[model samples]
Target chain A: MKLATIRHGATTTAAVAVNGGYLPLPARNLSELLGTPEWKHLVRVATSSHSSPDVIPRTEATLLNPVPAPAKVICCGLNYADHILEMGRDLPEYPTLFAKFADTLTDPDAEITSEHSQSLDWEAELAVIVGTTLRDADEAEAAAAIAGYTVANDVSMRDWQSRTLQWFQGKAFDATTPLGPVMVTPDELDPEAGVQVICTLNGEEVQRGNTMTLVFSCARLLSYISTFTTLRPGDVVLTGTPGGVGMGMVPQRFLRDGDLLRTEIPGIGTLTNTVRIRTRATIQSV
Target chain B: MKLATIRHGATTTAAVAVNGGYLPLPARNLSELLGTPEWKHLVRVATSSHSSPDVIPRTEATLLNPVPAPAKVICCGLNYADHILEMGRDLPEYPTLFAKFADTLTDPDAEITSEHSQSLDWEAELAVIVGTTLRDADEAEAAAAIAGYTVANDVSMRDWQSRTLQWFQGKAFDATTPLGPVMVTPDELDPEAGVQVICTLNGEEVQRGNTMTLVFSCARLLSYISTFTTLRPGDVVLTGTPGGVGMGMVPQRFLRDGDLLRTEIPGIGTLTNTVRIRTRATIQSV
Candidate 1:
């Protein structure tokens, strides 16, 4: 089953994709639905009845991020061996974790402004959405905690990221994380198996790699992170991206205004965003 | 007037601190009360009714974090001139911004376990709680955005913090940010004026400094941070701590099992937490 968050009027509504259409769920947001077992059961029922005429057309509706306002947006660093080598870093002995706040989140179609940052770059990553509250879960338990998978563009500012010891300063600029067209449940694809993840700028492929390169699998990541903190129902874990980030390029290709960024994972969906520079007056106007 | 979140039964209630006690507010949490015109009115009423009989005894109930789940928890790095010198780094040209998820938050008397980390440390910081939604606000507008002030202990793990270029991993361990006892409204204290802030370990003074040591004032920090992203109601801006972090000590004093951490500020309240180490069985048990 594919789940999504769609904008209906001024508010966001939980939805499930079915036969080229979307069925609005009786919930407010993904986080609220995640807290109830009944919601998951209802999603299965809704997906089974997708062919019925009661389904709403997916078109003519605006799509929001699949996992909006997650309690925690956790990210991993150097999970891919090739990417580790590209940045001249050693293979990490343990999974490196970081976080992005809800304010930095943006929808797939949202604009990523390059304001105050001239070295914006893109990293294509596979994001796992948590279904249940998990803490100190073992391997099997961690595997069961995963709800679905989605695509994310870990847009970063290279200059800012390198300025300090903490990468969050550079990684959490406004509208930095472009996430989701839809969330594809594990039944749709093998959660452990590798899948193709790619990124393109202005219709030109800039980064291409496979999830098979991940040094730490999803289960290990979930388990490792839970050791330090409790994983909430609506938390998101972004498995590290494979090689081919803009920083890996010889000349270091940075995102510029009007650059179209397309990030995708095979079974999930595509997340496309355009870069724009925010001016001081324009920012003040918001 | 001061504000706090109280757990009454299964629900979290927002309360106004009155003389010698508190008065329950109409809101559920600080986040819900922010940005409401009625909140300002409530503040006025609460201030005038400080000595009223309706005020409830604070000892009769539990006090939770002032802002349990803020829209964003923005943190600054080495923003104090003394801290910069202690860390042996040059002064920063801009306000360094990073973030922590809402899940990392806990109340004033909450227990903070450093089981997963062997080098946990404590940082006493003055946090600015946002009252209004602010984006690219000028200095004046930034000052207007402040709703109140609170004391926070930004607990960290040095090893995890230095694991990557991003400090989020070490900064966001579960139950790390123990905030509040009360949030003193702007009318009660001048944020720009320096205030005494201190921290102690096991009843021994470890840090003592004034907000005057801050390289950037509260107004400048808020205005600068808003340039990178939108500051929403109930959002918190943690102005950086001073030079006496445990990691900066000559012999390096990391938190160990049974260590008691107490942090306090002048107008705001004090927070106390005890640390416990994580064991293998403990990880499996959870």
Candidate 2:
């Protein structure tokens, strides 16, 4: 089963994909929908109902970030063993975690813009959405709490990132991170069994790695995070990107204005965003 | 005028500190009140009213964290020049910033506990609260947007903090950071002229520093942050701690269970929290 936050005309709503259309749920978006304990039952009922009167055709609706209002948007760094080895670092015993605000997330196909930094880069990742409250949860409990998985590009600005020891400033620019075309439930998609996380620049493939090489699995990452902070419904945890980011390229290529970036996780979905870089003088007053 | 989120019996309301009492506002807390553009007008009208029918006597109400639902809680690190020099690092060109969650905050007088970490440390700091929407704002605009000032202790778990390069895990434990007895509006308190930030552990002074020596002032920090992310009303920004944290001591001293920790900024109030560290064997399942 897949879930999405669909924008049809002026209103946006939490919706389930059914019969090649979207069946709107009661809440405003997926984040609010996930907060209720009866969300699954509601979705089940909606899917089984005979009425098709309210279902909107897929083409008429636009998909926004599946979970937009997550209170905590935590991202892990260097979880892929291959990526770690290439960067001359050992597989870390603990995940190097940082945070992003809900303001940082944009719609799946939104235009990504930056004015402060010229070195824009891409990192394709698999993002986990929590469905239940979790604190000090063991691996199994964390696994049971999984809501779904989606695709994201942990878009970064190398100039700002290298300014300080922290990566937050570079990674947290508003609307820079594109998340979700749709979220695929764990029952239908399993990263442990291996799913391809792929990234493309324009029309050319640049990154291709399997989730099997992730040093910290989804459950382990969630459990580790729960030890320090509670994971509530709709909270997002972005697993570190697989190998082959622009920063690691031999010539160090970066996204230029008008460059098209696409992030894909086979079972989940893909996010296609165009990069827009505005220089200081030409920067809009926003 | 001072504002606080006061709990009287089973209910909580945003209240104005009046003639030795609290006059209730319409919102549930300061965060909600600040979001409305007419908060100042509303407070003014409430204060000018002759009748005091709804004012809760000071002793009858308990104060929670004044702004409880800030979407962004960004913190600056190593901002004091003196602390930076003592740490053997030159003055940084940019502030080292990090993010914390709303869950990390607690009532000013709450007991702080750590079950996963043995090295509990305290960082006494002055916190800034945003009163309006700010995006790509200048220093003057950022300064004008200040809602008020408050006292906060960025309580950290040194053990968890040292596990990875990022300080987020250690800094983001739920209900560890104590954030206010009340919020003093900017007109009543000024950090530019210098405000002493003092910390005491078990009634003994351990840290003291003046905010005038800060490398990046509150306005500057907010300005820099607004360049990347939009800071909305009720968002928080901690202006970093001074020298003399437990980790910086010659022979490091950590907080033990039942130790009284106090953080004070003269014009604002003080936060009095009791330290409680639980061992793994005794850790509660919550």
Candidate number of the best TM-score: 2
lDDT (tens digit, per residue) of candidate 1 on A1-286: 8888888667777888877677878787676778777778978777776555666677745777877768788899888898999989998877777777666788989999866777888999998988877887887898888888888988987876776666776777777899888888888866467688899889998777877778888878888788767887778999988888888889888787888999978778888899886544332211
- Candidate 2: Cα lDDT at B202: 91
Weakest lDDT window of 10 consecutive positions for candidate 2 chain B: B277-286
* RMSD values, in order shown: 3.3, 2.2
What tens-digit string does per-residue lDDT give for candidate 2 at A1-286?
Answer: 9999999999999999989699999898999999989999989988888377889899998999999999999999998987887667888988999999898999999999888888889999999999999998999999999999999899998877877778888889999999999988999999999999999999899888888888889999899899989999999999998888888878888899999999989877889999988875443221
Per prediction, fnat is: 0.52, 0.75
Model 2, position A217: C-alpha lDDT score: 90
Q: What are the lDDT figures for the candidates, one per model?
A: 0.81, 0.91
Kindly list the per-residue Cα lDDT of model 1 for residues B1-286, writing each as its tens digit: 7788887657677888766777877788887778575788876676676656766676776888878778688888888888888889999876666777677788899888766677788889999998887776888999988898999988988877776566777787777899998888888887567788899999999888799878788888888777767888898989988878989998988887888999999888799998887643332221
What C-alpha RMSD does candidate 2 show over the true interface residues after superposing them?
A: 4.3
Stretches of candidate 1 off by over 4 Å are A7-12, A58-62, A278-286, B6-12, B49-51, B58-61, B278-286
Error of 2 at A51 (Å): 3.3
Per-residue alpha-carbon lDDT of model 2 for B168-278, expressed as tens digits? 888999999999989999899889999999999999999899999999999999999999999999999999999989988878889999999999999888999999878
